[model samples]
Target: MNSLIRKMSMVITESLMSQRTICTNIRFPTFLQVSSPLLAEPMKKKKKMDPQIIKAREERKRKRIEKSIKKLEKNTKQLKPIEEIDWPISLQKQKLLRERTETISQPQQGQDILKAWRSYKYQQSLQETKMIDRISSSQLQALEQLRAISEDLYIKAIQMDDLLLPFTAAGPSSTPPIIGYDVLDGEYIDETPKWK
Candidate 1:
């Protein structure tokens, strides 16, 4: 009887442990099915973006930019050049700014030749007079003083017998000379030609 009780107790403990290991709430694969046999069904389709579609989109964008650029170029071509239009003459002016800032007769180092040339102009002007000649003694003195500013300019202009014409008799003189303004612009009246 004692051996029978020990065997029955071991069997009960083993059954209780096995029951503890089991998950009782799980309804594992109660209605599992892969291929149905009750009725046939239509296949579902998947959509894909084709290469032709993507390439056509890119080509369309390129063409749009090209068209816009051509339009811009055409508009740019319509602009006018600087030489095309004849602007108002009043706006254009030629200023006499060369060596005007310096005194014309204050000689420095290598300026003796310039001094000689000025002296010669003084002598020449003294020897002659013209119809349009309105220069005073002071004016002649001032022009004589020009070598101080531009020795080369004064020397070159009066080298040949050329700088004395306008100050000489209006027409032909025994010697022709380069002439400058006695009256600046339109001061010459009944006898003299107006300055250009």
Candidate 2:
């Protein structure tokens, strides 16, 4: 009897499932149907290569890596030499000749003169600083006055001058130029040494 009941239950469940499937097919037709088949393929087998060839490839790769490492080491060990910093062989040979035989002592007024010079420099620096402060204060006062008088003019005055972008000035020469002097062009030769 128990076996008969189990068989009946299984049949009923199967019938219900079939009914559900039929109802779903009739009532809710699939809106999104896949046209393309699934991309399913067996995994490819790895190709067997010769051991000697593999070893040779690995050896070549290792040699290439070592060559690059050797190149880096060579570059790291070497530094570019500056020509100006190196002492000339001729100057090195004349070291003893260039040495002074007698030692000169400072004069008694040397310290006083140095102190006077330092004081003079300090005074000059103070005067320059004061002058700069005065000029800046005056400029600020002028800007304030302009701002109070006119807003547009003040705004224009505060903006950077584009005309001064390519500023160039010629300083006064030591001697006045001749009234009719013909300037001659001189050839320029570069004496700078090139280093690796």
Candidate 3:
């Protein structure tokens, strides 16, 4: 009876252990079975090329590159001509007609004329300088008078007027503004002559 009871208990324990293991496994979900489309397809076979054909292709590429380099080198030797810098062919053809051959008859007369011109220019410059000085002195005197009258007014006058920035002005027209007149829009035509 003891041996039978022992055998029955051992069987019951083994069944219970298996049940526990199954319960434990069921408690946790299995990992997701992830797969990629790229991995599913079979690998492609590489094509075998001839060595001589490969060398010929390489040689052709090298020759094409060398031909382009030679073309660039040829072009580098010749410079592009600029129209503005080079004398015009029309002007060069008329060079003989434009030449002056006349010589001065009296050098002393020329020197006297130059001296007179220089004196006139000097006098004009002196007059301009004196006028500028007078204008500046008058401005200073006016500023001093303003300061004497009111320091605040003088200070305000000295400060730069920011409102006058990006200054734009329209000149007075000969005709007066017409009230409620409909102005017609005209197309602008450039009449300037084109020079070659």
lDDT of 1 by residue, 128-163 (tens): 764226556655666578867788877775676755
Clashes of 3: 0
- Taking the tens digit of each residue's C-alpha lDDT, what string does model 2 give over 15-78? 6655553243645543333355688999999999999999999999999999999998889968
Score candidate 2 by lDDT.
Answer: 0.86
Pairs with backbone N, CA or C atoms under 3 Å apart (clashes), candidate 2? none
lDDT of 3 by residue, 47-99 (tens): 89999999999999999999999998999979888988999889899999987
How much is the lDDT of residue 121 in candidate 2? 100
Candidate 3, TM-score vs. the true structure?
Answer: 0.30
lDDT of 3: 0.85
What TM-score, computed on C-alpha atoms, does each candidate reach?
A: 0.17, 0.31, 0.30
TM-score of 2: 0.31
Worst ten in a row by lDDT for model 3: 28-37
Candidate 3: residue 191 lDDT (0-100): 100
Model 2 weakest lDDT span, ten residues long = 26-35
Off by over 4 Å in 1: 1-47, 79-196
RMSD in angstroms between candidate 1 and the native structure over all alpha carbons: 35.9
